[model samples]
Target: MENMRSENHRGAAMEGVKLASEAAANTNRRALRDIKNILGAPHQPQAVSKRGLQEKPAAAGAKSQPSAVGHRPVTRKFAAILQQTQPANAPLAPIGSERQKRNADTAFNAPSDMECSKASDDDLDEMMTNELKEIDMEDTEEEEEEMPDIDSCDVGNSLAVVEYVDEIYSFYRRTEELSCVSPTYMAHQSDINEKMRGILIDWLIEVHYKLELLGETLFLTVNIIDRYLARENVARKKLQLVGVTAMLLACKYEEVSVPVVEDLILICDRAYSREDILDMERTIVDRLEFNMSVPTPYCFMRRFLKAAGSDKKLELLSFFLIELSLVDYKMLKFQPSMLAAAAIYTAQCTLNGCVSWSKCCELHTKYSEEQLMDCSRMMVELHRGAARGKLTGVHRKYSTFKYGCAAKSEPAAFLLDARRA
Candidate 1:
């Protein structure tokens, strides 16, 4: 009776253990479901391993046989958790099964951590290359969208863009350096006095107008004549030929549509044949050593006018003053830049009724009021003399409406005669 009671007690203990195991598994399943919902993953029912929990029917189908003691089936999730927490020496799976044997072989033959890392780095490089290609494609599309269309643009009416004025300044500086004239230069020709020079220049101006050559061409013609006369002595008869040839060469140098040699011959009333003009042109070029890059007061006048913020009237007066200086041989003693600065200052004092040079003028021209005192006085005296003299080409040109009649107007007597010796 004691032995039978012991068997019933063991059976009851086994049933209680089975019920506890089922309850724990149910709790784990619920926890896993909660985790899946929190992670936004679809819930998947896990397979519960029943390796040791196979049920057998009792004799005559009375009841199910109990599983062996201490053997509780676990769900896949629970098995994973227990495996992670198990000691290194603990056996995870049965060694006798084919699946476990294959797993052991895979673990032993697998690549080392270093080898796996190298393979992962290669994969990462490939992925980065693909990502960079995608980024470059996006950048190219944005660049295409941002580009301006040339055909639809109105470049002429567009607001002025900043220019590299420094380059222009540099070019002018180089020209000045090359065109430097000796102040002590004196022409040797007895026939070519200052008065004769003035007459020739006046005729050149008329010719310049008749031909409609650029102002630059007239200035250059005078420069070539002066430079040549300084070095060469010529007969009074050939002086007119020299002037005509110089104009032809200057037109070639500066004019976009240069007058033909025949036109120049015609303008000279056939005084110089085409051959005579061509021969003199070659002689003048040879004597000057091909140094035709003579700087003119007009070059500096443009810069000074820009600096002074000159209007059309102020510019016209300044140009008139400069042209008057062209007839005076004494004005050649001053450099082109100084003549330009003095001309503008005199024009300002005369036309605008200003008493003296402004600080802005000094800042731009780099010439103080005192520095220009003598030069300005000389310009004023030249203007007064041109008014009384017979060479009226420049005077007639400036008296026209085209020059805003700048010559018809005169400066205040006090201003014109100021500091005159």
Candidate 2:
């Protein structure tokens, strides 16, 4: 078709013969393309009727129908039909730049009844398919224009893909349950208690901040720790080894530059050597079967914050609370989604001094104010204790100017009032 280019648009040429030749040339090009396409395909049957074959058996004095059709194959029948049609029109003439003798440029006689009856059903099928494709494309374009796009100002960033974001989060919501460990899994541990686990996390929080890692890397680190501990029993001495090894694995998974074994060992004041760390890494990988991609509160935190149409302060405070919950073992009772939703709810109550769980938040988070009350109350308590608690690593980290002093914000005491009543 591209090779059939000709100057035949309106006012492109004044000669009537040139226009007629151009039209005939385009039609011939289209027909040849269709014929070549059909011939290239496999296992196609001819569209001929059985009427001609039946007459042969009748005239030969055979009383029964033959089990087979006539001897015309698909390619032979198509070639014969096209050849007959070409001679019926006129002698071919060159019309376009690259004319290869396929130009039907002369005037044609009207088709006979037999000629029109010979039209194959393939032409009708092609026309219907083209029309349906056009209609479907138009409908999809309209639907895209009508649907609302929800994302941060970073939609311009190619990494923040708008398409499939909702589906991704919806899948996160459904499978979040599998990511959670038993709330009371600490009871079966022989060496580490919840308090010791909290201390390990507090130290890790400090290490994470000092390393200047991404927020997601921090969350993934904690998830790796909890999941490893849930499946295996570590000795009291090896517990810190687990924390360091988990953080190392998480950095490999989430960061471009990970801390080396020497840096981690130095942080622990050379308590463990390189071989111990390497051995611990191997043990953790084997115990957990290398399943590290799990959703955490940070995943839901970003999403619920977006749904709330939150300002910078609300975002910080929400993150501050969720990080605090990360240090406390009691928060394990709630799924990552619930913990995230409650953090936002508690943050909203603290900042606005009233219930501000909007319909959009509820719809996206799949939780209402009432349903989040228990978790919200727990988060509020963690907030109250953050400034003065032994696990004040999260508080001191958030209180810095970089975090906008999110830790200094007053706790949502109003949520605790309902619990007391």
Candidate 1, residue 11: lDDT: 100
TM-score of each: 0.59, 0.64
RMSD of each: 17.4, 20.2
Report the lDDT tens digits of candidate 1 across residue range 1-421. 9999999999999999788779878886533334432122234466434554333334685666454323443434435666677689964443445665675456445654555687799899999999999999999987655532222333353332225443565577567755655543554566667778889998999888777888888888988888888788877899899998898888888989988888888888889787888889889999999877777877788767876778998899998998888877788877788889999998888876766676656655678888887788888777776667688888888888978999877754555555553
Clash pairs of candidate 2?
A: none
Q: What residue pairs are clashing in model 1? A: none
**Which candidate has the highest lDDT of all?**
2
Model 1 has how many clashing residue pairs? 0
Model 1 — which ten-residue stretch has the worst lDDT? 32-41
Error of 2 at 251 (Å): 0.2
Minimum summed lDDT over a 10-residue window in model 2 is located at 100-109
What lDDT is reached at residue 132 by model 1? 100
